[model samples]
Target: MPVVLSLNVAQKTAPADHARVGATGIDKRPVDGPLRVSPPGAKGTAGSGVAGDSIADWNAHGGDYQAVYGYAREDLDWWQSELGTELGAGQFGENLTTQGIDHTNALVGEHWRIGTALLEVTGPRIPCRTFAEFLGQRGWVKRFTQAARPGAYFRVLEEGLVGPGDEITVVHRPGHDVTVELFFRAVTTEAALLPRLLAAGDSVPPEVVELVHRRSAVELDS
Candidate 1:
């Protein structure tokens, strides 16, 4: 029984500087059901554009998915142990910290209720260079990729509102043998497992499916 341990939201207030690789300022705030997303504006805040309903945008620029941010139950402990601070000291970036659910094992298409908001786990995040830069550690992205427990991303199926301390309950879990962790490993390392993952089609997203197909094709051609 997974539950939402905490919730957090932040706004980037300043441009990146030499000393800082990401937004220079972050303002944590509260939000309710029906999250909104628009194209970034001149002021840097997201403007009313297309609603952010895609995994690519949620994971882009810095793993900025609001839904997945709810899975950061471990961040607080990790930050305190390693960085000697809490999540809001401008070191670790995440929103909606959670607990109880094994996010890596969440099946794609599975839906969960976080307070009044409905979120569907769509896919696992693909780690990128920005992750490495954020930690000031070279190759950190590769290390995280290799670890293969990339957290889940969600789509707002029934928009409402969510906030810190919201409870999360699984509403649906598709039958799939492949876990998000396994899918990530297959994609980044043991590509031979791609076929098996794809066979569990219900649990994998189209982009992941295409990526596997492309890699397998290349391997066969080579």
Candidate 2:
């Protein structure tokens, strides 16, 4: 059974040496109380703008399709071994640090009933320059990408309050073989896997669906 190991939230803060010149909410810290969760907005406009949470980069951080991010403690343990450093909850900027669920094998469109909220697994977190900078790690983006264990992002289907220790119940799963890891691979280093994403249909977010179609078309044309 999956469970929320920790809940984290952060406020926008001024840029650090590595972060860009603007507020960044990636420095999330563990919270002791229940935090409200909701869908920020549709697609490109969604964010974690619910109470007590913030999204610094409205252009990139939040929207309907990425209302919350979840990373597995198991995966974090793996990174801890490789990086030789202690990583606390939300170190990866995830709102919920989870345990038990295999994020890599989480099927796209899987729905989780956490506390009073319903969330749908949308995709995997792709490594970005901002994320790399947050870690202040040399070649962090390349390293994380090669590791290929990026955690999951979710869209809020039903809003509610959630806290650490909340049980995560899988309420539904779309009948697709595409897992979060597979989708990430298709969009990143494995272009050859693009076409298979279509089998998941509308379970995948529109933007990525479009990407897959475009890439598949190019592959065929070439």
Candidate 3:
């Protein structure tokens, strides 16, 4: 019964001298189906298995789909409280701000419906230098990585327009044991949790699994 408390969009704008490029402007759009376009700055080369039309592209670049990257919403107050600031105002790198569910707990392959659009939770966001630039803090990337509460990223299985104040509901929770957070941790901190994540029996994407395996081996050797 989670609802979208608010939606926002970034308009094209110049990046701050040292500030990471946040989305240009925040606005409301319609959600009609799965696989929406990835927001600007997140697009990949053609046929990268990434739908480049909507907000998914931005997400692929380690941006949050809802709160900090595309739009800003208050529904993510918990993130602010936990991080001790306004996350949507540019703390968490989200696009669409949401409420009701803990994004970190949302697993891969899970489907969620917001308004008319359906999105499948695909993975956890990986922190990057952009995040640190946006936050104006050194070690911001490491801080987020160590926090282990990476937000969820989604792929549009159906395409549709979405806007602010829509209702976001879970349509399906895949019965997979591996979770988005675990997958993220496995890749980021391969030495610590990779084995456990593999043992969890969750369906991990091949790219992610391989990344973790390689890193894990390096850690063991060191």
Candidate 4:
């Protein structure tokens, strides 16, 4: 039942009100047919793993770890209700807009077989100033942080083609309960949850685990 409702790619970029001075690839549009998915190398080098998609802000946006961004259509509908606006696919700049998938509850290190490409969940999308500017909503960052439906960034495990309407199969799911929502909370508002992130093991990025250890050391010293 979990299928990709739409496959979106950034069509263009222009000046924006974000930290990235030149442009922001936040305006993504749904595309037809198969789109290639592969590792986009590093942040400064490659941008989006989805072929034809663009990433304007490389310094903090794209990399092998964040090859693709996925968001749930269900969550978008919820936001529509909250904001009283009809949101189209890729409105949140997601590469894959899926239906029937609980992205918020999806665990880190989860593997999804979508079309021919394989993707692994890496972390939650941290809302930034660009997101706020794109949405044009007051206190957007705080609201999104509190809502905790930040979506999830994915790493391409196997390069292949992906398209809209493709069924998403969960080929693997991590044993840990470190869901994306939990991870976002840990790094954002809920500092106490940081220690619990260790339960996720290497499923989450090493920097996250290192942060947990550093926090513990700081706590011990103080």
After superposition, the stretches of candidate 4 with alpha carbons farther than 4 Å from their true spots are none
* Candidate that would win on lDDT: 4
Separately for all candidates shown, the number of backbone clashes (residues 3 or more apart, or on different chains) is 10, 5, 49, 0
lDDT of 1: 0.54
Error of 3 at 84 (Å): 4.6
Give the root-mean-square deviation of each candidate in angstroms: 5.7, 1.7, 5.9, 1.5
Worst 10 residues of 1 by lDDT: 41-50
Say which candidate scores most in TM-score: 4
What is each predicted model's overall lDDT from 0 to 1?
A: 0.54, 0.84, 0.53, 0.89
List runs of model 1 lying over 4 Å from the truth. 17-68, 75-92, 200-203
Q: List, residue by residue over 1-222, the lDDT tens digit for candidate 1.
A: 555554444543344442234443223344442344222232122321213322222223222223344345564455456545454422333445577777777766677887676777756666555445546666767766765556666655665656555677888877776666666677787878878777565345555678778988898899
* Displacement of the residue 127 alpha carbon in candidate 3, Å: 1.2
Ranking by TM-score: 4, 2, 1, 3
